[model samples]
Target: METKKTDKILLFKGIKLLIFAALSLFMGPTLMTMALSDKENSLYIPLLIVACLICAMAVFLIFKGIKIIMSSMFDKK
Candidate 1:
């Protein structure tokens, strides 16, 4: 039987994605809270929009990271 080996470069890419996702996870909620607290301010709408986009990006990154990590570990060459 042949031996299986993990793809180190892809694995590292996935790790990087996870790290960015974690940062986004923290930032999204914080921005949302700020936007909510200052609803009457001119920046409120813009802040809310950005927070929603960042939150969505974080979720996408999490799933993409896991998929990349799995592919790196299990894909057959």
Candidate 2:
């Protein structure tokens, strides 16, 4: 069984995290837009909750991407 190399893992994780972050970022904005567009909608709370969650996930992903990128490019550890 061949073990995965660190650089390969970093590259794969960086790309995957960035992709997921992008999708989550889009979802968050769309949800927020939906919540804002219909002020009278009673489901705003749930939409807001989900939107916030998505946005938070996006932020986390971005941080992880940064970590992966920095470590892969410079840290060497």
- TM-score of each candidate structure, all chains considered together: 0.98, 0.79
* Candidate 2 lDDT for residue 12: 78
The window of 10 residues in a row where model 1 has the poorest summed lDDT is 38-47
lDDT digits (tens) for residues 1-36 of candidate 1: 989999999999999999999999999999999999
Clashing pairs counted in every model: 0, 0
Task: Report how far off residue 16 is in candidate 2 (Å).
Answer: 0.5
Question: Model 1 segments beyond 4 Å from truth?
Answer: none
Alpha-carbon error at 37 in model 1, in Å? 0.5
Which candidate gets the maximum TM-score versus the true structure? 1
Q: What is the C-alpha local distance difference test score of candidate 1? A: 0.98
lDDT of each: 0.98, 0.85
Query: Considering only N, C-alpha and C atoms within 3 Å, which residue pairs clash in candidate 1?
Result: none
